[model samples]
Target: MRARYGCVCFAVPKKLIQHLADRSGDEGHKQMLQAQITQSAAMRGTRASKTVAGVATNAGAKPLQRSVFDAAGQTFLPGKLLRDEDDPAGRDKDANEAYDNLGIALQFFSSVMGRNSVDNKGMRVDASVHYGFHFANAMWTGEQMVVGDGDGRAVKNLSGSLGILAHEFCHGVSQHLVPGGLGVVQVAGMPPALKGEAGALNESFSDVFASMIKQWHAGQDVKAADWLLGEDIFTPREGRAVRSLKEPGNTKLTWREDDQIRDYRQYKATDDAHRGSGIPNYAFYTAAAELEGKSWETLGQVWLKGFDQLRARSTFLDAAHATLNVAATLHGKGSGTHNAVKAGWKKVNVLA
Candidate 1:
C-alpha cells in the first residue's frame, strides 16, 4: 500500500545522542534518551522489511501532494493525518512546519533537479511531527519522516529547522536515488545499516544536498550560504550547530563535542557516520567554493546522479572516482567543473 526507502537514516547521529545521554545529569532524561535510541534501532527491521517487498510507488500522484500527521507525543509513526496538501495550515505549530518543510523539499527536487519525488515517480511525501515526549531527534524511516519536539535542555524545536528537515528528507532521496540505499546493506538477520565507508558517503550525500537545498531556497550563492548543518538544533550552551560542512570538527562552528574529520587519512573505521562524513562534506564545500556559483547550479544534480553508481559497499575512494566521472560526463573531459570536482576529492585525500 505504500513505498519505503531501502534503509533507515536519521538527521541526528546516534553517537551524538549517546553523548548527550552520557553528559545529562538528570537520570530520568538520560534514561528517556537511551530508550529512544533503542526504539529507533528496532525500527530498522520493520522499515527494512517494507523495502524488501519492493518500492511501491505513486505513479499518478503530483509532486507536491503530501500528508503531515500528528503523532501527539507518541512514538508510533504517522499517528493521525493532520494536514493534506490542499488543507489549510493547522493549529499545531510543529505539524504545519513539518507540512511546509516537506513541501519545500518536494518543490526543490521537482523544480530544480527535474525529479518528480524521492522515488522520481511523484510519490506523495508523508511526515509526522511531535513524535515521542521530549524526543531530541529526527529521522527518515524509509517510509516517511518522524520529527521530535526536542528535550529543551539540549536540542529544541526540531520541526522548525529547515536545514535539519532537508537533511532528513535527503536521506529519503539518497535511498531512492541509489538503489540498495546508497551505503546501506541488509544483513541476513539484522536491519540494513549505514556500515563502513559507504555509510559515511551516504551521510555525506545528505549533508551536501541538504546544504544545496537550503542555499537554493534562500537565494544564496556558495559564498553567501552559511554552510552550517542543523545550526538551530542545539541549545547555545551546548553548541552552535550539529555539523559544519565548511569546517567539519570546528567546534566553534558547531558544538563543543563535534568529532567530524575532513581528511580521509584521519578517518577511522570506528568513527560514526556523521564524523566520517566530514571528508566528503568538506570536499563538496571546497569544490563549490572553487566553482564560485550556486551549489545546485554547479554540482547538485551531478552529485545526486553520481551516487547512482554506488554499490552496497562503496568506499570513499569509490565515491570520489564516481562523482568525478559524473562531473566529467556532464561538463566535459577537462572542463572547469570537472577539475573542480576532482580538486574537492583530492583536497580531502580521497583522490590522488
Candidate 2:
C-alpha cells in the first residue's frame, strides 16, 4: 500500500556531526562520522519510500492500545513484539521505555486535549525500538513510531526520551488532523511554494506540542519549563538540546546557528523544513510566555483548535489569523488570551 505520509525524523543536526568530527582525535573515526552524516542527509530524500505496513486494531473503549516492538538492532521494523498493553514489563529497558513513554503521550492527548488518540478514534499506538544499527534518529512512519539506538558517542537511544516520543506521536496527530496532512504535500509532488510553508508548519506544531507535553509531565509552568526539545537525547557535555523555543539562537554547540527566529525579516527560505520552523515556534513560545500560566491550558488549546482551521497551503500569516480567531472565540476579544495571541503574532512580525 502507498505510505500514508512522509514524516520527518529527529536526526542529529549536520553541525553537531561536524563538531564531533572536528573534535575527534582519531582520523579514521572522524571519516566514519563524516560518512554517516552524509549518508543521513541523502536518506532524507528517500524517506517517503519507506512504507509502514498496517496492523489491525482490536475494537473497544480501552484506555490505550499500545504495542512496543524490538527491532533488535536490525533494519527491519516491528520486529518481534516485545510488549502489549496488557502484558507486564519485560527485562528489556528499551522495550519498557518505549511502552511507558507511549502511555505518557496517549495520556497527554486524552486527558489534556480531550482527544481519543492520535487519530481521535482510539487507534492503536505501535512503536519499534532498537531499529537499525546505531541509527541515530527517530520518526513517525505514518503507521507507527520508530526510534533508533543512536551511536553512543554522538547520540543516545532515542526511545528513552519522553519528549521525543511525544514529538513523533504529535506528527501522527497532525497527519490525521491537519488538512492535506501538513508536510505530506511535498511527498505528493506539490510545488515548493505550496510545500515549504506546510512542512514548516508541520515541524513547528510538533515542536510546540512536544514542549508542552514535556512541561506538563514535569508539572512545570511556562516560566519554569526549559523550553528545549530532545534535551535528554544529547549528552550533557554537548551542552545543547536539539532545539530551544525560549532562546532560538542560543545553542550548547557553538557551530549551530540560532534556530529561533523572532521576526519575519529574519526568516530564510530554505529546503530544510526544520530550519524554517523557527518562526512559528517562537510565536507559540511568545504567546505562552505572555499568557504566563500552564501552557497546555490556554495557549495550547487555542493552537490545537487553530489547527483545524488551517488550509492545506496555509502560510505563517494564515496561522496567526486562525490562532487569533481561536483565542478570541475561546476568550472574549478584549480578554487577556485574545490580546496575548495578537501580541505573540505581532512579536513574530506575522501580524501588523
Candidate 3:
C-alpha cells in the first residue's frame, strides 16, 4: 500500500521545460535552474522588510535555547522522541510536542510525496520553542521555525499542536523551494495590490500542506479533524480551534476588534498589517479537499510545480495563472486536475 512519484510524475509544462532547456542547455542543468527559480518564486510576494508587528528576526536569539533534530526516515511521535525539558524551562513540553510532530510530518511527507525532506535533501529540521517574552506567534526564521508561548492567553504553547508545528515547518519547505534562492524580495518592491496576496498565498500553501500531512496521518478524513488551529497551545477558555480549513472567520477567539479576531477571514497577503490570512487559507483547504486522495500526491505536486515555475514578486493572479500552467502540464490542458485548480481559485474569487 504505497504510492510513488514515478507512478505520477506530472509532465513539466513543455514551455517551461523548453525554457529551462534553452536557458541551461541540458536537462540536468535545467532542473538545477528550475529549483533555483522555485526557491526564488516563494519570496516574490513577501514585503518582509517593513518589520510587521508580530514577525521576529535574529539568528542568535535563542529565547528558549531548545534542541532540534532532522527526521529523515520512519519516525513516529509518542515514541523515541526528545522532551521539552531537554531545553530551557517551560519550553520542554512544547518543544517535545514540536519535535514529535515534526517526525510525524516528515513521515507523512516522505511516505506520501516521496520527498526526502523539506528541500528533498534530507536537511535537518530544527525547531526552537518559547521564543521572546510571551510572544504570541510562531515563524520560520529562514534558518529554523521558532514558536512562542502566545502571550499566555490565546496561545499558551505554540508547539502544543501538530498542525501549528507542521504549519511553521511547511514554511521551511516553502523557503527551500521558493524564496530559498531569491534572497529576499521586500514587500515594498512588489507590484501593487498583488503584493500581500502573494505572500498570503505562500502562507496558505503552508496551511494546505500542513493540513494534508495531518489528514494523511489520520488516514484521509477531514470530518475527524481537530479543525482547531493550535488547539493544544490555546487554553480551553480561549475558545476556537486553529484556523478553519473549510470556513474562515469562524473562530471563538474574540479580541479587541471582533471583526479582526473572531471573524478569522483570510486576507490577501499584502503589506496590509500582516493579519487576516484565513481567507486564502480556507481557499487552499477547499482546493485540497476537492482533489481528494493523498494530498502530497496530486494537489501538493501541482502546487510545488506551480510555485516552482513562478518568479519572485508574483501576484495572486500570477499564482493562479502559474498554477493553471502547472496543472495543465501535470494533467493535460483539458484534464480534471486542471479544472479543479481553476475552480479552486475561482471559488475563492481568484481567477486564472
Best-fitting candidate, scored by TM-score:
1
- Winning model by lDDT: 1
What would the per-residue lDDT of candidate 2 be over residues 1-352, giving only the tens digit for each residue?
Answer: 2335444544455666677777768787678668767655444444444333443454437878898888888756667888888899999999899899889888888999988778888888888899876667787776778888876766788888887888889988887887567755553343222146667788888889988998989999999999888888866665467788777656653225435555777776654566667778888888889889899988888999998688667888889989989998889897999998888889878888
> How high is each candidate's TM-score?
0.93, 0.89, 0.63
The superposed Cα distance between candidate 3 and the true structure at residue 28, in angstroms, equals 58
* Total backbone collisions for each predicted model: 0, 1, 21
lDDT for each residue of candidate 3 in 216-323, tens digit (9 for 90 to 100): 767765455544454455455544454555665454442111221112234433333113345455545556667665556677778767777655456666777888
Ranking by lDDT: 1, 2, 3
lDDT tens readout by residue for model 1, 291-312: 9989999688778777888886
Sorting all predicted structures by TM-score, with the top scorer first, yields: 1, 2, 3
**Model 2: which ten-residue window has the lowest total lDDT?**
186-195
Evaluated against the true structure, the overall lDDT of model 1 is: 0.82
- The lDDT of each candidate is 0.82, 0.76, 0.51
TM-score of candidate 1 to 2 decimals:
0.93
